[model samples]
Target: MKKLPHKFQIPLTVAIMLPIMLTAMPAVMLYSTLPKGAALFEPWLDTVTRMVPFALPTLLVIAGSIRFVVTKWLVQPAPSL
Candidate 1:
């Protein structure tokens, strides 16, 4: 399989990860936070709306930082022939 180009990688990763995280995180948190028999729709939507703006840039920055550090310092070069 072909790898995505470097230019496309962060955006693609965010696009995929964001929706999954956004949907799953709030549902789990609300399930625990909301009282039994309480409605979830309004709270869930509210959480999503409130969280997305913060989460996107945070996730993007984290991913980019990790990629930079790993490629810069952690990954070793291929052995010479």
Candidate 2:
């Protein structure tokens, strides 16, 4: 098997993140559709609501930082012939 390229390492990580983004939609929809407004604070639905807003931005920031750093420093400059 061909060893993965160093440049592919970061991109592979970013690509793995795509499925998590896809799952968030259904997760949010399920949260909204559930009749949790009348329920107390300890339910699983409440956890989803509280956690997603707090966590999503943090995730975005982390991923963005990784992308910025890799693009800025890790990628090899084109070799001048």
Candidate 3:
């Protein structure tokens, strides 16, 4: 398979990882906090369905802002010998 350009790397990574993290984190949290043997499947499915639309854009904005800040303000100068 052909590799994508360097510029696509971060965005592609975020796209792939964010959904997995979002879904998995919620499942872990809900399972731990909810009563044992409580119905899990329906609530998890509903939460994921309702949460994705709002969470995706909000997280994208946050990720973009953090990327901008790190690139803009976190650059290091060449060290002198």
Candidate 4:
């Protein structure tokens, strides 16, 4: 498969990543708001936030590779013009 332009990849990655972060955010915040006696993973939550979006880039690469490989083996290539 031909490489997709950044214009497409950027948005594509975001579409895959946003839901993951949204789901994790509340869990993190609720943990932080827990009772004082509870372990405060304040620093860890901060770190997780920064590290969170990173999964998108990796996801894009892996998904693209899988599609490309599957198309090569299982998909019939388009006939040349």
Candidate 5:
């Protein structure tokens, strides 16, 4: 696939990453918190519901911050020699 511009990459990454992380985090957390052999569907649904509102903004901020940090600190300057 063709690559995206840096300006387009941040939002694209956030969009792709947020759903996977959001789902996986809550699933793992709920699994650990819930008793063994207990029902997971209801709890997972509830957790996802509660988490969605907060997760979106948090993920966006995180994605933006990472982009900024990587661009500023990691992307090396061209060699002078």
Candidate 6:
């Protein structure tokens, strides 16, 4: 299979992370907050819709910041021979 170009990395990351984060986080939140057998699908859908606009930008910014910090300060330099 052909690999995607490097330019596609960020967009691909967002595409993959978006659904996983959106589904998992809201499900967990609703599961804890709603009553048992209190009808989850509608509320989970509602929460996901409400979260969509904010989620992408937030994910990008946070991921970029962490990547920057890790590369800048957290990673160790190779030891000299």
Q: Which candidate number would show the highest TM-score if scored against the true structure?
A: 1
Go through the candidates in order and give each one's C-alpha lDDT.
0.88, 0.69, 0.85, 0.72, 0.85, 0.89
TM-score of each: 0.74, 0.43, 0.70, 0.41, 0.62, 0.63
lDDT of 3 by residue, 1-81 (tens): 998888798889878998798789779878998998898888888888888899978987998999789878997655689
Ranking by TM-score: 1, 3, 6, 5, 2, 4
Could you give the candidate ranking by lDDT, starting with the highest? Answer: 6, 1, 3, 5, 4, 2
For model 2, the superposed segments whose C-alpha errors exceed 4 Å read 1-42, 77-81
Residues 1-81 of candidate 2: C-alpha lDDT, one tens digit per residue: 889978798679767875566556556666676775644334545656666786768878997998789879999766889
Off by over 4 Å in 4: 1-18, 25-47, 77-81
Lowest lDDT sum, 10 consecutive residues, model 2, at 36-45
lDDT tens digits by residue: candidate 5, 1-81:
987777687568767887898888889988999999999889998999999998778866986898689879999865689
Judging by TM-score, tell me the better candidate of 2 and 6.
6
Give the CA lDDT, 0 to 100, for residue 57 in model 2: 83
- Provide backbone clash counts, one per model: 0, 0, 0, 0, 0, 0
Report the poorest 10 consecutive residues by lDDT, candidate 6.
71-80
On residues 1-78, what C-alpha lDDT tens digit does candidate 1 reach at each position?
A: 988778797679778987898888999999999999999999999999999899878977988899899989999966
lDDT of 6 by residue, 1-81 (tens): 999898799789878987998888999999999987799999999999999889878877998999799879999866689
Say what the RMSD of model 3 is.
4.5
Q: How many angstroms is residue 67 displaced in model 6 relative to the true structure, after the best TM-score fit?
A: 1.0
Question: On residues 11-80, what C-alpha lDDT tens digit does candidate 4 reach at each position?
Answer: 7876777777755775677677777677556655665776668766887799799888988898998778
In candidate 5 the C-alpha lDDT for residue 48 amounts to: 94
Which parts of model 1 have CA positions greater than 4 angstroms off? 1-14, 77-81
Q: What lDDT is reached at residue 65 by model 5?
A: 100
